[model samples]
Target: MSPHSPARRRTAIGALAGTALVIPFLAAAPAQAAPCHLSGSTGSCNGTVHQPGSPGEGGGSGGNSGGGSGPVAPPAPVGLNPNQGQGFVQVPGNQAPPPPAKPATADLVAQAQAAAAFPVPIVHTAPKGKTFVRLRTSLWVDGFHVVKTQPITVGAQTVQLTGEPATVTWDLGEATRTCDNAGSEDGKACSYTYQRSSAGQPGGAYQITATIRWNVTWSCEGADCDEAGGDLGQQPMQSEATPLVVGEIQTTTGQ
Candidate 1:
């Protein structure tokens, strides 16, 4: 019949099927795998993986990892004892503060002055004679004792201040003299013999004044130290003025 017949087509199809089966058998196959190894906090295939300990890992009681819920906070620090600490002792909130600092020296001095720490100057001897004669004199405190150790409280501090005469300064109306450590005794060492009559001076007499210097010191219950303004050293304490009459001695020998 025709060149292309049914028999011829069936023969061609049979040959194609046989060729496809042989080609699949000729293709290459996959290679074999190497062994997998693991170490502490690390793993490796052909490459490796590593994890290290974080800083302050063992400082406190807490987990190192931050994976669970959230991070674990470290323990609280321990407090120190105030009485046993090495450096500066810590003051407790409940502890009472030290007694207020001692009052200033100037304050103590003012208190003493207010209390009349030094007694009024007393003239032991009065001058009664003509010019050229040595004026016999003495000066002293009437009470001649401490200021009774008066206690003066300022702010929160209390200081006891005691005072007494340390020196005496004399104003002879015409001249002045300062005697140290001279209290309650004959003042002959500091005496002055007037050379002229009182007619030249007011009231026809010399007006004499004695000033006593008070030496003050202060202290607290626990310390013997002086207050800041205490120890005013030598403070001038004055006395009322006294009049002395000096007349010229008459010499009616050879008229």
Candidate 2:
């Protein structure tokens, strides 16, 4: 038989046909997923987890959802869906809600005042803690940063009430006196003359209280400062009780 004969040509044709048939069996297989290595509370997906049944994905495809904008169960391979409360993947620290908004200016003053911790009034007296009946007892206060300047946050601005003494109303047991300023120990400004002695009272003393009225005005700053900043309204702060001994005078009348 010759090399160019029909028998030789037929054998070559069969070999080419066999090679073509095996090519379909050698076609590529579907890709295997990358393995995930979770180290701690936080982990990363080896490849992005494409959660099925999400918005664009058709309903009930891979997940149990009827679908619409709802959270679907994610793959458990990458530690997903562990902390999910609402059916979505819960990444730590990424889900914190925003903080509360600042209150309106009108509501801010009273709210700030209630929250502010202005110092309480400090009480002081003249006559070195003792006095004589029918004598000028000279009752007064030590003030000591009384009429406290309090800085409060109203909206975005800082408002401060005046620290200067306003009115100190002294309850002197027998009489009440209000001073335009912190009372003076000298007989001039805020002196109170006791008509009766405190000898009959408990511990031979009169328990005195000073109520300080603070100047309430708010000065505003910052770009958001408003006309609402002025005159937040006055508030009264009372002082702790102080003790004063009043002794009766002994006078000898000529017989």
Candidate 3:
């Protein structure tokens, strides 16, 4: 039993050999899942465990459990094309949206008539149905708004129409004249001088009339600009006729 004895050495060697065999068995044991606390019959294990029906690695439904880069994304749903884009379907640059439908001219004309602010002819001199033969009878009308068109929307496109006074026409029951500007109340424009009396006319007065003509245009914005656009031509509005009488002044020569 002495520390240096042959029997003691042999015993020490046998103990060392036993320790080596036990160390290999410990190393070969399966690793344990951390936080594996068991409470009664039900407990939780953090380590991977195969359920009775669950596929392990390549054995399960979606991907092979044997693994390379991780589970392949399930095949894109049937009939859907898979895209590499970030959640968006890429559109071709050459595809262009269709233009809006053209608006009906008749419909626009009706709308313009409803929205138009018409001007009545002002008989500056012939208001009382009488005027001097040698003096000019003044008549004019204001150039008011014809207003904006109702918005026309087709698909993703929209259009709005607008109008402006373009011409004015004057009728004196015998002659007609057109002007580039609206009639002026200053008597410099839209005045007519009677060369003769209105004795032969109906109601003993000549009928006078004034009309305003507007030109309409339309515009669009954004991607639909210039679509469903057109001109509405000349939309004319006339004022009621006024009866005017031209009389001659009789003066006797003094003796």
Candidate 4:
């Protein structure tokens, strides 16, 4: 007892060192967590496993054993129009095209008549507005002779110069030259030097237009000048109108 001193203390220290060394070997190992496994298509976890007294404990509680639950959400509603959808639904927007343009009025019949009566035999056809015929003659006449065969224009009716005599003015293109008579029979004709205002048409064709206006006493032989024809009318005096055409290119000199 004098000194359980130095040696005893040394021995105690050695023993402590030895115990520290052996402690790790004697302790239980940590429990390992299993990797998650994807199971049946349903994808719901079934169960889990755990170590009873292992050094590493409580880890098994949160371990993934292929039986762990997977993320889940509610299913969408059934039976809706396919076009109608969640995020964004494309739409063809409603729209109207521009209104169709209006067509132009065609005066085909009138144009045909104009062309046909281009340079001869003035025909007074009833027109909607102010229809007229211009006659270009070699002789210039101040007066005009108007006779209604079947009442060509203004319908089939008799019109007379009664009461106050109507003063009919004659208009010959630019100037009206006085003449003895004007018509097919003895009507004054255009001046001898009369030539087409414009040039003749191509391909030996001549297009000349002349106009004359006059005031004549209205009367009919059997029927009044008013009552006349509809589609066609016979020549009252000589020809209601006169149009002369030369050859395609030749002049009176050649013909």
The prediction achieving the highest TM-score against the true structure is 2
Q: Point out the higher-scoring one by TM-score: 1 or 3.
A: 3
Point out where model 3 deviates above 4 Å: 1-128, 143-146, 222-228
Error of model 4, residue 156, in angstroms = 32
Q: Taking the tens digit of each residue's C-alpha lDDT, what string does model 1 give over 101-173?
A: 6566556556655775456766544433233334444443354345645676655555666677667777876
Clashes of each: 4, 0, 4, 38
Assess the local accuracy of residue 248 in candidate 3 as a C-alpha lDDT between 0 and 100. 78
| TM of each candidate vs. truth | 0.46, 0.53, 0.49, 0.21
TM-score of candidate 4 against the unseen true structure:
0.21
Candidate 2: global Cα-lDDT? 0.66
Candidate 1: where is the Cα deviation over 4 Å?
Answer: 1-116, 127-145, 153-157, 181-190, 222-230
**Alpha-carbon lDDT, every model:** 0.57, 0.66, 0.63, 0.33
Give the clashing pairs for model 2: none
Superposition TM-score, candidate 3 onto the true structure: 0.49
- Please give the ranking of all candidate structures by lDDT, highest first, separated by commas: 2, 3, 1, 4
Candidate 2 stretches greater than 4 Å from native: 1-102, 144-156, 226-228, 253-255
